[model samples]
Target: MHRMLSYAKGLLWLALCALFFSFSLLLPASAAVEGGYTIDLTPLLDALMPSLLGGVSLLASMVLAWLLRLLARYTGVVLDEKHRKTLHEIVVSRLQQIVTDSYEGNRSAFRISTKSEVVAELAGYAARKAPGAIRHFKLDQNGLEEFVAGRVGAKTLARLKSSPKHAPARLPPKPAR
Candidate 1:
């Protein structure tokens, strides 16, 4: 029904435009009252025809191009930094959760995508409490490079001689209701 109404409106508008144009053609040319000046209204019609067609066509093409641009922007696939960052954070957080949860609440034997962040936090946290026993424990990962190795410092590394080799642990899955 809405589609039919739109089509009817379009046809009605076209018909009205045609009627106006035909009526415009029937009008007599203007006569000049002053010195040797002849006014021809036919030139107005001639000029209006070309200008109206050109303007309308240009406007239509521009509108179509704008709509297509909007559609492309909405539907097009654009993988950028934000997408990568989101994925990286999700994986990092999930891996960290799994690593932290796998053990019986004590420091787990292993970590995933550790790269020294959570380990440094744990080490530093333990250091404040124990100090001597929790020596230099440096977290490590192979493909995931040392993002905070320098920050861990030398003194921490001395007591923490053995950190487990970097490994990919099973990440925790999101819960199902």
Candidate 2:
């Protein structure tokens, strides 16, 4: 929008300059004769007007093309951002649902061996849910695994912290040798 405004200002300036130049050309010029001066510039102004208007028309067309290109690029960026945000929400929700269903009443531990299985299932689930986004965002197996593992670890830690049964135990005092 800001770019469009600047282009509009530039076009206004060009129009003003063209108007001033045409007015200046229309004013009569004085040429000295033997005993007097005569005013005449009709022929000169007639020849210049067509070429001047043509040049302005060409410049205006070029500016219009450039503005259209900028608008297309801006629209593409906004849509990509919207897709990315939607994909993130879908992945997070799916992860929570899978974790809840698989590990209910078993939050005491999230074993390292089972983490790979969970990640694999999550990748498949996401692919099924938003197939277009998976390709658009260029998500690979390694990236998906890392993302799932991180979220799972954080969730497990939060649950453990909140559970009284899993509270950290203090070590007893050591006896003097």
Candidate 3:
């Protein structure tokens, strides 16, 4: 394709040059003697005019090509920036929704799932802050069951969970004999 384009450009240049040169040859020589000074200016004008016009046309085409290249570059940058910005917005909004629903859904639901390794690491951070409050800190499904049970009952334990302010500093183990 590139070779074909180059060949086409060379042909166009040759054609333009031929046209400019031939215009002089095509003109019938009309010699006028002005006070013994032979001025064959018509032939010169014919050659110069077509060449000048061709040069001007070529220069204009180059400037238009340069402007088009600049325009394409600028448009591409703007579109890519907008695409990245929109993608970031969509991801952030989805994460916000997940965080909101994780804690605000039905009361019977177990919270702060630690099944995934990443979630377990995050839970460890929270557990370290309030080690005495959290229980059944494991990756097994049974931990989710225990969390549900701890959050559902209506006894002092439930009240302690409800109003963390009145919760005891320490809680007894359920299986203690």
lDDT, candidates in the order shown:
0.47, 0.64, 0.47
Could you tell me the lDDT of residue 40 within candidate 1? 62
Cα lDDT tens digits for candidate 2, 60-96: 7878887887897877876677767776777678766
Candidate 3: stretches off by over 4 Å: 1-8, 11-15, 26-63, 71-177
Count of steric clashes across candidates, in order: 3, 0, 0
What lDDT tens digits, residue by residue, belong to model 1 across residues 1-177?
466456556655765786698566554323243445665657767867775676567556655766786776686433333443443454445435444444323345433343365445543343344322222223233312333243344444432334333335446898999
lDDT per residue (tens digit) for residues 6-124 in model 3: 75577578768867665655543332343354546576667678766776687567657767868978777655555445433443343344344443443332343233432343344
- Residue 166 alpha-carbon offset, candidate 3, angstroms: 33
- Give the better candidate number (1 or 2) by TM-score: 2
Provide C-alpha RMSD values for all models, in order: 15.8, 10.9, 19.4
Give the clashing pairs for model 2.
none
- Clashing pairs in model 1? 136-156, 136-159, 136-160
Best-performing candidate as measured by lDDT: 2
Best by TM-score: 2
